[model samples]
Target chain A: MIELKNVTKQYPGQPHPAVDSLTLTVPEGEICVLVGPSGCGKSTTLRMINRMIEPSAGSITINGQSVMNNDPDHLRMGIGYVIQQIGLLPHRTIAENIAIVPRLYKWPKEKIVRRVDELLVMMGLDPEKTRSKYPSQLSGGQMQRVGVARAMAVDPPIMLMDEPFGAVDPIARTHLQDEFLRLQKEIRKTIVFVTHDINEAIKMGDKIAIFGEGKLVQFGTPEEVLTNPANEFVENFIGYDRIVKKLFLYQVQEAYRPAVCRLRPEEIGNALSKMLAEKAEVAFVLNEADKPCGYLTREELEQEETARDADGLQKLAARRSKAFVQTTTPLPDALSVMLEYDAEYVGVLKNGLLEGVMSFKDIRRHVYRREGE
Target chain B: MKMSWERFQIALFEKAPEAVLTHLLIVVITVALAILISVPLGVLLTRPRYRKFGVVALNILNILNAIPGMAVIALALPILGLGIKPAVVALLFQSLLPIVRNTIAGLLEVSADVKEAAAGMGMNQRQILLEVEMPLAMPIILSGIRTSTVYVVSVGTLAALIGAGGLGNMIIGGLALFMPEYLIVGAGLGAIMSIFFDRALSYLEYKITPPGVRAN
Candidate 1:
């Protein structure tokens, strides 16, 4: 959805252009990352997308329209922008921070509130718990999440995040990346992310753009770039231990869940019988959103079958995390996600529909493929 | 020559106090005015369009600072005349060099990561200046202020020669009087004022400069 044609950026008195004559295209709904050492102009290229820095030469188009003629204010509104410092306007509250772009675009108050609430839930944050806090009051992770929330606030089709998680500590950074990857699956915005850290670029990006000395070294999917680099710079840029890096992408992110024959608030007896007949260990108790509010394990069902008040059974319906993902996410990211929440799996929400499993079998296939490749 | 206790106390209070107070006022005003002009000027000097002129302006200010205070007063007498105005002008001239020079250095030294973050937000030059650069520059610039204030306070006594009536007047008067006490009072007060400005500015230095910006 975003395309660059022969872009070049030359700072005055500099020996060479910061972004050399370049042409590239970032496909719709993909996470494209630009990465290089300092002064290589990976950042310049990313900035050029939003016109944060005007290209010295060539053309850039978003959604098939050239950015040169496009009004920057309007163009920026259509593309989300994030920064390393999590620039949430320290003066503003979290809710206000998330509401900035929408307010700028004249989105109605009701719509803004609705969008905020929805994002807060999807990002796994309690809006009531954290929405009123300022950026300074938040933990580094919380502030980073708020930054993403603010970027996603307007539901822009394209997002430009320049090392968005760079300022946070490593543990927080990993968690933020996982949460963002999950969020991206649901929102599907075309994103151009920038970072100097190669591991981060490989971990979070669908495709990676490598740079050296203000020139494009290579642009390709992680596997292609790792396996067959475009040039010597690209190969060196990928660095050694690349095979180890490639193996991280094989995550057991998706899985087919047990058929969820759930019980209504009133039908405890029937639900218990179904659980016993199926020899099921657990089953979901869904709420209005068709989301699991809680789970009923076999032990609880058995106890209810003996001498239980329906009320007691409902009490035992604990919010256990049985909801899990489909096989879309690469294994390493999926493993990272599982590691994040201390969960074995996460429910992959895509296209507003539940997809089947991402399990060890899927990851094993990739690992086995690695042995051959 | 044994000194009486009562006589010494009276001498200390009467002769020493005026010089100290006058010295304090001269130094304070000079440094304050220097900060007022230089901080803003220094900030302006570092802008991209003005950067090339930075070396030029800095050289001129350094030369101005190098001139002796008495020479500055002598030069100013025709244009500014004999008064506290010349004292202030001299102190102001001495005070500005460090404030501007340090400000430019401090502002330019901000990390590229932080600068890039500011630029990515779609904030224009003014926003970056006030919000990002200035706040970060406060500490280093304050050090310059501290250095200049100490220097300005030391030179403030020079105002006495031009009849500007600072602590310098007491020393100069004491010198003429051949009353050693008067000389002690003037010289002692100048030293005290210098120490005070240095300590106060250092305290402010701690408060304004964020941790990790510099070494202690």
Candidate 2:
């Protein structure tokens, strides 16, 4: 747990601290988003933790140990950081960029190389394609991936990302945000993410801390922050669309299976028959034991048949080729996957096995429930 | 007896195929040396605690820069004793201020946000300086170097007054000898090098320096 006990920061001759005696704690394994308008001290509050900006008053403790007592270098090595511009070293290759923290900690050369390669792949980059490429050659979205890769290089327990997705275009930004959320699930790192976007805060934050003019105006879950705004500033910051925003959060879950659907070789015929009988046109193909397989349409089978020799067609066998989700995956993500694959449903899996299927129909039903409440 | 201006002029151009090369060499050497020395100093001076001291140092350097070239050469004559060293020393000192001052201005011109982004990414001070700050400051530094080069070319003519050999010695020779061609060659070469050099350095500066590091 990271705790900031009434931390404050005042520039010399300033009338008030940029962060004013604000107190907060971010529990382990949670995403705590700090957000506010420009100059509200959210950024200052974030920077103060790393001692990039010193707090004028109050104390900061990481897992109950005072950060002030430790060398700032040691304190920073254990924390991951990402920034708005994605702060990549322009001259360095993606691998070397991610290796910075490990190199700083004097990790062995082979270990640094191994860690860099693993993180590159974990951040969804192909090490072969990206490892040697300099920062300038990558797009905004790719740069953010490298930044996230760099942050995760040392496997720090805490990650600090300051508007990491802000530089990318909207489509890329949304995609990156989803990828970031996915990474958080896999890593389960305690994250302190700062942003000014309410939608992002609602989507990613387990807890939201809203700031107003150097003071923390509200601190609560997204539901509480949006539905029960602490004051006029927070209400205004959250805007009048709080109802719709809240609805989007829970509505996606309703649209379908938030679990992985997989089909094995033996179940392929049965799954295909179900789609044909229901006239669903497209069905998710789950493997025999039930896991996410790719979407299949009768048209795909016909195309394959026409392309093959008659003898080959007679010998053709059915197999489930795709696996998709784990339960607890966000609705927005699952829905997008369904939409992208042009399927009516997706498979939900828990652990390595398939649990159930979620259809668009099921998702609508969930949305209806949220609306009624 | 004093040597005739004709022979004095020969010492100036002794190594030159044409007398003009003596003046060209003096101007070129002075500007090059100034650039080599001042840009780093200028960049170093703009740092936090050093800013005020940097400004004051620049002011003093500028005062030195403004001293009459002939007077500088004359002042150096006693210690440097009537040769290329005194002439080159005077011109180099005079050329330093503009290049150094402009280098500082250029470096300070980089956006603060860019610097902060570099720092927050776990870059130590040296990394930020060598990687981000210096690259951004290069264009401005080059401009300073160019400005000083042009100034030093014009000042090289004054070196001849103190018996420090250069094309200026030929101009002085002609003035004493009433030989118009020698004066024309010396003065013409100095003027030509000044214009040619400013353009050349400006071109090199533009061609080589990148717009900026992608802090975005």
Candidate 3:
């Protein structure tokens, strides 16, 4: 665990301390998000942990050892740090940028190359295509991915990200956030994420630490902060859309009702019986690989034309299932897909197979009930 | 007395060779000295501790740069007396401005975001400067070096006034005796030398620039 005890940072010639006796603990493998408006000292607190900004008073310890005890550079190397600017070295190619820390630690050449390509692949970048390209050649999203890959080069247990997704457009930002959350599931690094966006905090943070005017207003799980805000400042900071924001806290996996039956395209007769027997409006169509290709509604199946050709059902379902989301996707994302397709229910997939479906009605009940609590 | 092809050929092949060699030597030494002194000084001035002094240093270089070359050569004669050494010293002063100014500007021009990322990634100050800052600043720095080299070659002709015995010697002699052949020979070789250095360094600058930076 990383713990800060009464940590304070006071700058000279400044009337108020940047951080005032702030104390918090980030349990191992949890993402603790520090969020507040500009100049609130959330970024200051993060810098202190890495010794980028030293505390004027109090102590910071990682697993019981004071950060002051170790060499600053040595301490930093073991902690991964990413910034909003996506600071990949412009002069270095993607491979060399990722290899920086490994080379510094004196890892063997072959091992570093292997690790570089492995990281590129892990970031969902084509290793062969992206490895030799420079930062300028890649798009903003790709550069951000490379930045994260560079930080994780040493596989540091703790990653510090300062608005890491803040620079990209909203669409790319969401994609990056989802990809990172999925990666975190496997790595489970203790992460301190700083941002000004409440929805991002809710989506990415395991524990949200809210700050106001250089003081931490509240620190708890996203649900706790949303339900039981410590004071007026936090309540206002979370804004008037707290109900909609709460949708971000729950995943599709949690809120989705499991599908009653999923049938292959060739199972026309079976699909008809399943829809009628369950009295469901829609039934998901799965391909040979068991992946949801699309859905056939009761109206469409009843038309008789769609069911006549077994091969025609496959051709009809070729729209690529726009109204589908992975099980880990946040409810708000699922809602977006539903709205985008103008559908009431969104298909939730687990490992590309149809696991269930979540409807707009389901999210209302889930979020409203949680809001009441 | 008259403009003769035979006299021009003699100036080109026989007397011109020694003057060209001397001119090349003075330009080479002066440019080398300017680079050696200016590059490190420029880097030092850009350091956080020394950044405050950067303006003062640049202003001083700017002042030295404003001085006329011949006047500088003449001013050097009173202090160090007349010779190739004094000529070189004067040319060296004239050359320092471009290199030092460009080095500082180039290093400063490196993106702050890139530097912050380097530090955040655990690179020490030295590593950041050598690995990140220098390579990025190289194209600008080389352009500065290129400017200084060409400037030094053109100005080395003035060193002949201090008895440096360069292409300037031939030009001065031709001017006094009114020999157009000597004038053309000296001026042509000097212009050729300047253009050659400029083109060669431009090529080097292009070759060394990172592809990412080049794209920009």
Name the top lDDT candidate: 3
Ranking of models by lDDT: 3, 2, 1
Show where candidate 2 strays beyond 4 Å: A90-103, A106-118, A126-134, A224-227, A251-373, B1-37, B53-68, B71-86, B178-216
What are the per-residue Cα lDDT tens digits for candidate 2 across A265-353?
A: 45555544555666554455444445444555556655664534423322332232333555667666676777776666566656865
Instruction: Tell me the native contact fraction for each prediction.
Output: 0.11, 0.13, 0.68
lDDT for B120 (candidate 1): 49
Q: Name the regions of candidate 3 deviating beyond 4 angstroms.
A: A252-330, A333-365
User: DockQ scores for all the models shown?
Assistant: 0.13, 0.20, 0.63
Q: What is candidate 2's CAPRI-style docking category based on DockQ?
A: incorrect
Cα lDDT, model 2, residue A90: 54
> Against the correct fold, how does model 2 do in TM-score?
0.72
Q: Which order, best to worst by DockQ? A: 3, 2, 1
Model 1 spans > 4 angstroms off: A10-21, A27-29, A35-41, A63-66, A69-80, A83-157, A165-173, A195-203, A206-373, B1-25, B74-80, B184-216
Residue A226 lDDT in candidate 1: 77
Model 2 chain A — which ten-residue stretch has the worst lDDT?
A: A310-319
Q: Give the alpha carbon lDDT tens digit for every residue of B1-216 in model 3.
A: 689999899889998999999999998999899999999999999998999999998899889999998899989988988889999999998799898888999999999988987888788999999999999999999999999999988888989999998999999999998988999999999999999999999999999999977965
lDDT of 1 by residue, B67-167 (tens): 98778877777778888887788678778999999999988986665555445444456766786678778888988988988787777777887778867
Q: Give the clashing pairs for model 3.
A: none
Query: What is candidate 3's lDDT per residue for A182-271, written digit by digit as tens?
Result: 999999999999999988998899999998878888999999999888988888999998877887788887788885467765685466
User: After superposing the true interface residues, what Cα RMSD does each candidate give?
Assistant: 5.3, 3.5, 0.7
DockQ, cand. 3: 0.63
